[model samples]
Target: MRLKSRLLPLAVSLPLAGTLAVALPLAAMLHAAAQPPPAGAAPEENAEEPGLAYSVSLPETGDSALDDAISRASALEQLRERAPVDAFGLVSRALAEANNMRDALRSEGYYNGSSRVTVDGAPADTPGLADRLAARGASDQPVPVVITVEKGPQYTLAPVLLRTDPPGFPLGAMGETGLAEGQPARAQPILDAQGRINQALRDAGHPFAELGRRVIADHDTRKLEVTFLVTPGPRALFARPGVTGEERTRSELLARMVQPLEGQVFSQERIEKTRQDLLSLGVFGTVRARAGDRLDEEGRLPMTFTVVERPLHAVGFGAAYETRYGPTVSAYWEHRNLFGGAERLRLEAEVNRLGTTGDTSDTGGKIGASLRTPWFLGRNQTLTFDIAALRERPDAYDRDAFTLGALLERTWSPRLSYGFGPQIEFSRVTQDGVTTDYQLLGLLGQLRWADVDNPLNPSRGTRASLLVNPIYSMGESNVFTRLRAQGSTYFDMLGDKGSILAVRGVVGSIVGASYGGVPPDKRFYSGGGGSVRGYTYQSIGPRTAINEPAGGLSLVEGSIELRQRVSGPWGLAAFVDAGSVTEDPTPDFDNVKVGAGLGLRYLTGIGPIRADIAVPLNKERGDSAFGVYIGIGQAF
Candidate 1:
């Protein structure tokens, strides 16, 4: 029923009766003949040797939008005093601008508009104008040139006409093009209507559908009548796609990826979707899709996918610094197409606390390797295997651990995804001068939804993630479930003014285990640059008899920031963060810690370079006066 209502019968007649094409040529003639050049002369380009210098004047034209459009369309205003010209040359330049101004006015629905360019109150055809300017001869004083426009009453669209090359087409196709009669007759909307009609035709299974060449505008009735000549080419179904330009990746794998799209009705949206899917494999730097100009013998449209592969291998390194945490360095080596099939293998290492106030033994490091195979089960699915060895010496605990995990990730849509897997870990941790060894087996599940505009520096939209990991400690003979959820939302407070409001919140808990029974590293701790800035790492939670940090079973954290762009590539943020760590499984606010900070952000090609300084509002005796943090992205 919906389809029947949306589309007319295939035999619907499209006609162009009672239509007159009369006004566009006259407007064109007026603009073309606004200020014709003298006999046998042409406009000259700006030369190093100055001839005549002139200033341009473009006053407000009553309508702000028209004023802006005219100003932007004026070449005289853009060239300004930098381009010197003689009297004839100036007249030529001004004359050329009349067409541009006329087009600008027509774009805003003023079909009967006109423009005039004058030099020192004299028109271009004024007698002796060239001699007068030649006499000035590059003087210091700028010659005055002015542009004026007279925009007649705005025009509305008359009943628009539709014509099909084959004489009969769907009459309902025009409903969605926003080309209804009585609307303003702006040139852009009329052009855009044609584009929309073409896309609609393509969506309706005509792969080669396009606009025809008959756009007529009549200004006699102060109305525009657009004649959209639709050419609905042969409708076709999708055929097998051919792949090319692959050096290492298996062609069979790419073909299998597109198998689901074969035999469907030809639609541009599906073609683009397949193109993006191929690019998401990560091995391809570019992917292009082309539909055959002619159908095959089976009446299906053939498709071709061409991919340009990225470098097979790459290596990179980076470093970051914070006041107390000191400098951290990291490096990675990656093989994007390892063993082909778009498999990715990466090995990375990181070292932190290069020079801190603590002993040299307090430095921490990690070494890890991961491999990801896309299309593990099918399209939009991936399988990943990871192994890592890490050491950490934070204020709450000291740890040495080795972990192994295998995950299956699936993407349900552009903004939603989920992953689940099993993990194994072996670790020796020391806390409060007591050492303990544990072997843990865990199952982890994660779900994420992100619709933000930018991953590194988002200006709008919201993103959220939830993680649930259930672990059994073989040494302790206990099982615990860890649950954490975090979300952030950004608001563009002043459009085009570069103001944003970003808010974030996190809540986490450990159940089925006591606070002391859980691994210290897995337990929640608040403070430091990433948590409650201005306080030392893990210093805001419960403390032992000697005031050393004791990790908590529950956590609650939040941050709010107002980001304002002061100028191009430079921005500032003022933020407040608050958090609490509780011994009980349920979070409590009794010991909440709050920190306030100001940050400077320098936008870069990769992301923003961030530097922030904060002071604790509820500072205790040992908290620092202020803390400084630096990194390559917005602090979560």
Candidate 2:
């Protein structure tokens, strides 16, 4: 397993004093201390500060001695959890890192010989002076620094060797020629050869084949060689992998899912995939595996699995906040083993506390449940029946809705999926405390293509979805046919400085929304948290019956984002988004709200840490909507 890095994001701007560094050389200050003494002190004598101390104060340190000072400070902090100098450990580390960078600059030929290091201090009589000077062994003495560099060492590869008899190793058909069939013994090439050799050995059934001494590089002779002495001391044969404690699932079913085939070698990829394939089933709560017990065949190993399933009858309740949904809490109860069999039944309730519901009211709630036939259409298809009621609260707008729907979903392939359903909706919307009622009936089909190489941290891939609904409604609402299409694709940057550039777009329309006018609950409105950042939610669609859109619909929206890693510990992204909702698809762009901003992401394990500020291109009077979103995972 990989260990996660524990570093925090910077929430505030760094102090201005930290941004400046003198360009000129600062040296030759031997007044007993590097800094000038405190205020109101004697004019003559060794002018020393009262709170500057150090254990190692050399009489004659060089101009760039700050490098040494930084190193010492870092080492002291790491060893004792405290820098020898009186300063926060984090501050010491930051300064030490800066000092090392300056030293490296000199080493890289940006040297200016006449440089000085000055860290001043005042009398211990000042407030909090004692606390600042709390570093052990600190005194009124000069702390030495060293800033110089010399050439780094270089070595060459020696020979290529592998302990295991990789397929066609020494040469031949090259499936595992060990060194790519007579390739040059370069430093990196040798290491690559070793890795390939290890894979080959494992492929041949020696699951425990080991590689020793990665590369042989000689300094004297500009030569290089890669060697991997695999410990393929014994021949290991394949047998059925062990599956223990799975009384719930058929042993045969579990065996079939444990992949890489029976005879394949135990590689990390295969082991991980075995876990993933099982996870996709969503049956077991936790999964774990390993290359089972070792046999006496010197370097042979077996694979084994120890799995524990979560309770079949489970109940859970959780609360989540989304810019689009506002704040919602859901409570659910699911029974995997239903009717003494393998079916599932679930019930849930959801509530919302913000955003307009076409009526611009401010309080809403939803409760719904689904009874699913898990074995529908032979395990791959899902047959679901559900009923729900929703009460929405938009700023100055509000609506309440009741829905009854049924859906059939199927996953035909890894890359293709579809869902078809029919729904009936009844709602009452309130705007500025005024309420109205509406009704809607519709049938819809949805298709999706979501095959990204990495679903969790996808850098490149395409995902597109289409939604269609033909419905009829009345009572202060429009009865119309709806069509919606949206897609997003990403591509990684080319060359060495690789990153990802992604593009996304959405377009929805009211096909025949001509009669009865759009109801307060049926018409789409735009602006707010989720739609165009810097705006509100659902505020992007069509206008309301009042001639002004409480939540605009009927518009085309799109955006392009360019992302890159600006530093080892940081990520940078820039994006521009623009869109608007009018009577038609060809709305004037001049009236569209366009926003742009930059975001910074620190690779936090919780997910990508993000902070973005979007400014509208066409800022209108009293248009003061700017979005701020923070959470785990990517915005998508």
Candidate 3:
């Protein structure tokens, strides 16, 4: 009889004629292979017998592709805590594993493959195998299982056909659906082609598309043919959208956030986008958007948004430590839905430099409150208000200030946003024992673009931002403008294994003012964990006679990092950072500083926890030999 075109569902096990010539007891073989027990135990006669153990071996097949497929599908390779306790259990498992190997070969395009399982010079299906195992006494020996496979010629695909009722759709334009003549005949590609056809129809405004498939195999030619029948249903438009699971939140507000207009063409893309928008509000724990099963009387598809609200109130606290700044602590309390329109209010406080050996006056703290309103006046827009009081003393200056500001931000797309705002500040500044009070009015504008693959741990993409702030000192005759731009790009060297190369650059300048006229806090300074790493904060700029820092008007910085994932939950990084601060408005590359470091990362659910140790490449007097920093997230 000839083999049929259909798959072989049952595994075949038969005894080999000459393989069992040496018939030795199973316990004797196990004893010779077992290792001695730990020391200081009772004598062998008095001790309890050790449990049975087993090991599996798969020899190379001379064909790399076939060997890899067998390794991936081999049940014996994936077993961890599933080892059998007795000889009978071991023989039963061996018989089942033979079937698993045969199925694995079929998935890889090999339809005529064969597998054999053997245990200690005998086939797994030997009659009276259980009786033979019972004859051996209890022994602390390990059993050996060997699996061998012979993968036949792979089958290729034959002519492929797709039929639709309309007969005018260009199916070829759907891009590589993975089904093509002369390619390998695999089950995955055939299923993928069916999905692609259905999605193409739906994307083209056919909301109710369906697909059916048929496959035929020819054993003589070793070829497979596939066909798909597509049903392109009638076109449909979106109907009025409804919201569910609303308690404290107003339905009208959520409707505005959804923004699905009636009579628009139905689109799966739009439905998914609406779901993401609702989740971004931070007020919902879950959001789902789906279309009605059938078209309405008017040929319109009704849409529904179901959501689960998050807790209205929350409180969080965090802390970090650095060699230069001691320990810093922060806390915040928030009301996610202060009013009915997805408004948020948060109050926060922070204190830094708790146990540092620097000047006692160089400690700092702040208290602030902020409010944010989503969907302000238009879609993808937000309005924010902030008020704060801060006191900080650094190497260059001391500041006591109060600030109030309002900003209006608009998100043009998923990757771009722009904002403009007005701020007022009243500050008391002290430098070199001289105290001066000033009131300032400023207008700030900012633009940002980011298309990173991930927000917490990105391996590829780019991020950039620009800010321009013009300020007028009401107490002094000083007017200056601060312009800054920074950008970073990430590249993945090894896909998904977390090997990445990241580069960043920053440049800034102060126009319309001399070095002496710029506010100490407003001027630029670089060197710290957030900057040049190895040096202390504000230590790279000009200095007084006593070696205290004097802030500068121009700044330029750049950094490069090579990150590699070591193992699960662990990673390693090597980096180099360089920057300069100049007194002139335009950077002259004077007094530049360079720092290099190595870091360790432990990945977590929220983000990566980082620890870095750095040394100054161009160390000056009074600079620390090295610095250590511990924090959350990437350095950028």
Candidate 4:
């Protein structure tokens, strides 16, 4: 009986003991791999680890991982200095990292080795006693570390293919996009945009689109061929039972928003766009759209919108803090539908506290809104009109101004828009009363070209815009006239790598000098984030005889930037800028105030959050000490 009792317990206990016993060696191995060497001992540096805590030293001391957290692109010099704990699986992971890195750099058109490690001081072989000791106490030796980098293989876009389902697909709409044939198709954004095109086609009532792609490579030629295969199912129809969320949108508007065609091919684009259009009303809490063959035969997809309307149209407020602009707050009231039918109207008040001017006129603001008709002329067009009023006083001009204006806008297509109207202007004297008071009639024209399917971060494509405004005064001593032109361009340097380059230019002047005076507000003022980065608003314009840079008429401004993607929806940029304001129509180019700066971007829902600090190469009296800008979207 005693022997039996002992054996039973021993059997159970022995298994437990074995488990713990075996675990110790395994634990030891892992511990030794990641354990750091103690101070004051020569040791062999081991490979790097992903989770291992590390310290990096760059060519420039400011380079560090913490800096990378807020940066758009990572710095290679800084990346080279990271030191990971020496441990198990370290060498193997390092060896197998090639594929992982290839994927990461492929987006940037640089599909090369993303990392390189070197031991500059760690001896290839430690001294006899040190080696023996390190094997036992790897934690007790402090090892010297050094590394170098070799940037590797680069690839370019090779081709794209188009695939269709059901074997026989209609290619009429494609109309020589050339995408059907293989072309040098580089950049993920472009690829994504192509996806959007497919989606748009589907949305256009072609619901049968099947989006797929294939890649072919030629090793000898170092070329890649990519083909997109599309399978478009049978045409679908709008056989609706009823519409939900009618309370959120007027029944009439909701009805207009619905396009149920019989025998029309279903498209993913149309479904999503209808959803977006619904949300654009700003009346809904949430809007969802789905289209598939779930409700029909022959894979016929029907469009349905599930919507959640806002509970209330009441007051809402928001506030934000930034390094450059201390704090800002804005409040607004909106009605999702003023008189029903998904029409929208909103009113807002705002205040801002800037670092230099405290809370002055620049901080105070007001706005008004109205309805936007999506199909003013046709499905591809839209029309909108708004009226707004504002009052404010700023420190720079020691001025306060109040005015009301009305504007009417029309969009011929999604890519093109234009607007014009009239304004009654009046202002309190502040800057020598050089030009003030007028009933102004303004003419405005605008044009834009943007191919990116996504608005938040356009990976690949180009966007260009131009705006011209000419204002003429009706009642005045002398008939005053002003002409202004602004142009901007967005380019994806390499597209999918999250890299971008942007440029903008502005030129304005008083044309056909009028006997009537021009309002100070109507006159062009430079500086701040939009004009000169390092100067305050109105402090960067044409200089007077005393070399002052506050007042002027004709002005020229421009900026260029190179953006790089870092990690996880972040980016970094380096830029150069130049501009000048001239009293005369023709200003001296060499005499302009030029500056350069770096910027950081966070891709947010609304747009990219931008922060930039600029320093001017040429500085004069009353110039800004340093330029700090915080805002949404690009400065241009």
Candidate 5:
């Protein structure tokens, strides 16, 4: 994290001469002490001496303001480690420490403050102290150290002046330059003022503006005067952007990603946005965007974008475990720049329900491949094609399925996007020992909006999505539509460091079809880690005569969570989820099943590793006592 310094005005009126008299004795004591050895090393002979024990204290002054400043400036408070082998070492260290304390006072505008150090109840200058300590090395007693300080009257600014090359520049527009007359005269404020002025000029189109002079201090009159001489270079406009370091990704594609327009007023913000856009593409390992130091003949600033390409091919594996479903394992291979133009291709395989109390026929698996291309006919759009084969044996049905689909997605802004797609599928499904074959074709549309601060672990903002699918059975005379909508919102109850409240809701329905007419795999079920939890997967809806789940035509689910950071990289969460699946076209709220749970989060650079344990509030005979889930990222 970056540290920022601020200029705070000091309010005090005291005589500097009086405070100096009190500090003069302490300064004399420090001056008489011998120079200490370099830090982290001890003299060979003195190494035998035990480490010295010491304490630092500041006696209260009648003035509360000076006392507070002294406390803040004390060296003892800032030292990470403190140990001295002998009296000589202690006095030497104390002498160096006194100088640091004095500098701290000056930073607070106390140019005439005084400080002193004492060891073993006596001033450091006491004669024969080193010899006495050498004789008492065998003793177990610890040495005591003390520091005294007297901060004199703070200084005030006098007749501050800031001049730039351009005439009639508005210096007042720069807030808190820290150089106004009668304000505290401190080093930090003056330095901060210079930086603020330089930045202001750069933001106003003077990219080359810089400080040209120094500050002058007048101690005799207890006043300071500072001058900010600056060079405000000529304003410039942006020229066409240039790109380099391209191997697979096309140069034209990169050029189009730069948002700044030619001949527009040059801006630092615009340049930064262009850099971010390139990074979002994910094909570049590193990206740099900078404006030329020299202007072109047309008086336009030429900008260049240099990037390093990342490796195009990669393979990885993933796994997830649940108490109810056992474990699922997956692997994938990807080519990020397939055929250039920033296209992507990926192939994946996954197996589920390992180590469960069931035969191989009860297990499930999927194999799939997908391809995506950027700038599909327009800017900020993508076209994707996917094909997959799957086998599953859930309580409601057993099935072998094949699907092919294509989607066109468009991003309107950073926070909003929409997609439409067409899909076809063929399936062989079995229910209650009876088998049936079906073929279906569908068109799907979706809209989504998210303004969350962090995609992995959001502490603020809202996210919402809507999906609609209209389907026609090719083998049978049947038609139906499925619509689902989900929304979630997050709030930081105490800002970044405080707890977060996250709430989510989902609702869906299948229209124009009865339970027997729709595919079992496409029907809604409200159980498992991503649904009502606590209950077994697909176990919360209508049930057959044999107690197996019968999938429903409608769904309703909601969840609420309170997440708190317990310590560094560790967090705790408590949540409640409730939902129901109904055979009716509309949800039946009376049969809702509720689950409550607790979760743990370990924060990582990419996201959080999460584990959750849940128990059903309305447990049925077939429901397990508890369910455990482990995965990466939040459940939502």
Candidate 6:
């Protein structure tokens, strides 16, 4: 068997005849075997016990990988430690394990490897071996068993050959099929090469490509030769896609999304892109695309888009706590496919600063409604409308406002987008004990780019956005242009989200207006859990005569975090944040404030639940010594 150059049989039959000889009761069987026996007692050939225990030890095979594989694949090791077996049963298991170990070696390119099994220092086939162990008299000691292997020289590959059934079918480069001469002929790599060939053919418009392989080993040269047989059906173009399983979503909306792919050359990349586009509509839980088995008369392939829609309506609530700013709560209700065109509508409300100050004027809450219409006027564009009414009392100001806005957003590519719209607002603001009413109209413009792998918890890539707003005050007759830009990037220090470095930066300014001329709600302030962290909400900017935040015309903020995953569903993060806000049109670094913090994270299906504690590095007389924040998702 050692020199067979092929895998050995792994199955072994139990010889019940050996156990039948010792079927008598233990007390009588032991006495008969030990002594010369009673005058009329029948002589038993082999003695055994009902309870037999043994431990298996595998010696080094000079190759650590092969030795580990043998231990994992051994049935004897798993059963002996778990199930109770008699002496004869144990011997039968050991005989089966010998062949398993040999197969393990052959999988690692050692076709000529050999394995030997023994019990109590006797070969497994030794006559009366089980009787020797059981005759020791029902002792509790575990019998010792040993398995050893000798792995010979590993096999290498001869030149790999690829053949197409139709002969000369376009397969591109066959030389780079991940197989080469003299490379180790391991089983996994050989199988992976076949998958690569099939995928390549499908990517080149051969949707029904099939692959077959033949592996032959020459023990004389210690080499394996492999040939991949390919059957590439017919080249195909994509036909109009058919959709199914849509309960509320309109079929015309889906057709509009896939119109660009119809009559085009079939491509795996395009299919994946179309699938992802459907999922982004927020109505589908899963989307799958399949190709027809037969090509049409025009040499075109029929495609189908199968979808599973998510629940049409959902409601959720969230809560967060901060040490000095007190607690905040929020809730939202959403309809995913309103009007049957995959339109989304949501209503939300939030309350903040609970249990902080005894005065009711210190608390704030707001309610708003938003709607999104997909495929609005164009395939790559969407229309969004929002209306909100809110009253908020932060350290910077106390104000009440009602706002309405609409936007037309266009997606240029998977990673880039831009939008522009008009908005109107009516507000009554109180700043530093001065109250004023104003009606404002503005033009809103925005640009965004994102290439991150995950939105809630990202370990790689960058996200960035820019906003420009030009507002005109009806009563004050003052015009101001607001500009803000923010960007964040993530580095995967250790692959697979085990360790990451995340960085964020922001800059903003209000041009053509003084700090006092702009409305308080529009002015930028830089403290709170989402900002500097160690101070109260809106607490880190320019101050008035009474030592309260006066809001600022310019702002700058930056943060850096090191995130490390500790174990399953748990992680840790350490971060530093810095920010500055000034009455000037540009940032003043001299007024920068810094905070340092550590956080704990529990990962869930939606995102990571995070809790952070931070201390002010440059503390002031009124600043809190430390701030604690709890919420969902990474603190970007």
Evaluated with TM-score, which candidate comes out highest? 1
Query: What is the per-residue lDDT of model 1 for residues 363-427, given as tens digits with 9 covering 90 to 100?
Result: 99999999999999778999999999999977778899999999999999989999999999999
How does candidate 4 score on lDDT?
0.51
Q: List the residue pairs that clash in candidate 3.
A: none
Candidate 6 segments whose C-alpha is farther than 4 A from its true place: 1-68, 76-89, 130-145, 173-175, 476-478
Every candidate's lDDT: 0.80, 0.53, 0.76, 0.51, 0.76, 0.80
lDDT of 1: 0.80
TM-score of each: 0.90, 0.57, 0.86, 0.58, 0.79, 0.85
Better of 1 and 3 by TM-score: 1
lDDT at 485, model 6:
98
Query: Candidate 2 on 296-369: residue-level lDDT in tens?
Result: 35344667777766577788775545454456566888876454333467877766664435443555677777
Give the range where candidate 5 is weakest over 10 consecutive residues by summed lDDT: 21-30
Candidate 4 Cα deviation (angstroms), residue 120: 31
| Residue 217 C-alpha lDDT in model 6 | 65
- Total residue pair clashes for candidate 3: 0
Task: Sort every candidate by TM-score, greatest first.
Answer: 1, 3, 6, 5, 4, 2
lDDT of 3 by residue, 598-632 (tens): 99999999789989889999999999999888888
- Candidate 6, pairs of clashing residues: none
Candidate 2 worst ten-residue window by lDDT: 23-32
Q: Residue 456 of candidate 5: its Cα lDDT? A: 90
Error of 3 at 498 (Å): 3.7
Better of 5 and 6 by lDDT: 6
